[model samples]
Target: MFLRKIANAIGGLLFLALFLTFLVQITARFGFNQPLPWSDELAVILYLWVILWACAFVVPEKEHVMFDLVWNSVSPTTRRLMRLVGHTLIGGLAIAAIPASWSYVHFMAREKTAVLGLSFEWVFLPFVLLLLSLAARSWHGLVQAMNNRDLDIHEANP
Candidate 1:
């Protein structure tokens, strides 16, 4: 619960930061003769982090996309089983993605982008943490499904 609050607070700030970056970029382009070289680049990078970070906070809210038509068609017990299985797969992917991305981020630390002139690792590092957080969230969802306690679950009927 404490961790979730921290994630939410961080996500909210990141979102605001992303918005501020856009505003700054627009202001610089219009208000000044020259635009900031790294504004859009950093904005884009932060946008990615905001997205991935938002995912962790969202999963508990059952915000991920789903194929409801198929799941709705199944029996209640079957539906529950399928939900568990699907969440397990997602959790596994998040788990795998963390390590995979960490390795890539580590590799990128040795170099930096030209315009941004910042270590790519700094931008990419959050993705690893986000992926791991997602894994944790998905695993939590899987447990909720097993206990039939998930409130926002969806299913496909066909």
Candidate 2:
């Protein structure tokens, strides 16, 4: 889908930025004998964005870690039931945390990073996006489970 492509693009861009930041940090530290103070902070922030962004958007559901000892042993009916219960729990918890997460991110507006002086809210905003993405993904899973789709536990994507 178009949205998925955009998400992938964003994730790729974030990773590229993180790589460039590290290159800058390393080059300055060794080549110039003077490390940039803000580079470290920027790198950390970009790393966080890259990881959470990948998890929330780029990665597919089947690619995630699964304790499949039970899932693999289950029947199709049981697997559907498990999907329903699992998605419900995950989506419910993610939805429940949204308000608190938003509040904390908003409250962090006054705080700034040590070296970059970037507001904490902007730094932490990806967390909110992650939570929202989790909830949305779970909802989609729930719907698919209800429709009896994706009940089989495949070893790999075909």
Candidate 3:
């Protein structure tokens, strides 16, 4: 819950920052007859962060898109099994991505953006975070599904 709130706040701020930066760039380019070279790069970075963080923010809430028509028609036991299988597969894929993503991030460690000179690794931090958040959410969903199954079983017995 707390992480979701934080992700929301951060995503909002990133979006605001990206929007304001674009506005500034436009104003500076046309209104002032001067263009800021760094603004475009900054906007790209901010946009990337906003997108990645927004994804993370939605994962915990299961607000991401899914085909629920078939899901809703399934039996309870079958639904639970499907959920566990889905979450497990997703979680495993996410786990698999971590090291490759980490290597990609590190490959740019010494590199910097053209205009801003910000470290490329820093620029790609949100990608890494997105993967991590996805994994966390997947595992969390798996656990929740298991617990629900246990509760359902207990209720049936009681």
lDDT on C-alpha atoms for all candidate structures: 0.78, 0.91, 0.81
**TM-score per candidate:** 0.83, 0.95, 0.84
lDDT digits (tens) for residues 17-136 of candidate 3: 999999999999999999999998999899888888788664434445667777767788887898789879988998999999999999999999999899999999888888887788
Using alpha carbons, what is the TM-score of model 3?
0.84
- Give the poorly placed runs of model 1, Cα more than 4 Å off: 58-61, 151-158
lDDT by residue for model 1 (27-75), tens: 9999986799888898988898888778756444444666678766778
lDDT per residue for candidate 2 within 46-109, as digits (tens), equals 9988988999999988888888899878788898999999999999999999999999999999
**Candidate 3 residue pairs in backbone clash:** none
What's the count of clashing pairs in each model shown?
Answer: 12, 0, 0
Top-lDDT candidate index = 2
Predicted structure 1: lDDT: 0.78
The prediction achieving the highest TM-score against the true structure is: 2
lDDT accuracy of residue 153 in candidate 2: 40
TM-score between model 1 and native: 0.83
Q: Which stretches of candidate 3 lie over 4 Å from their true place?
A: 149-158
Candidate 2 clashes between residue pairs 3 or more apart in a chain or in different chains: none
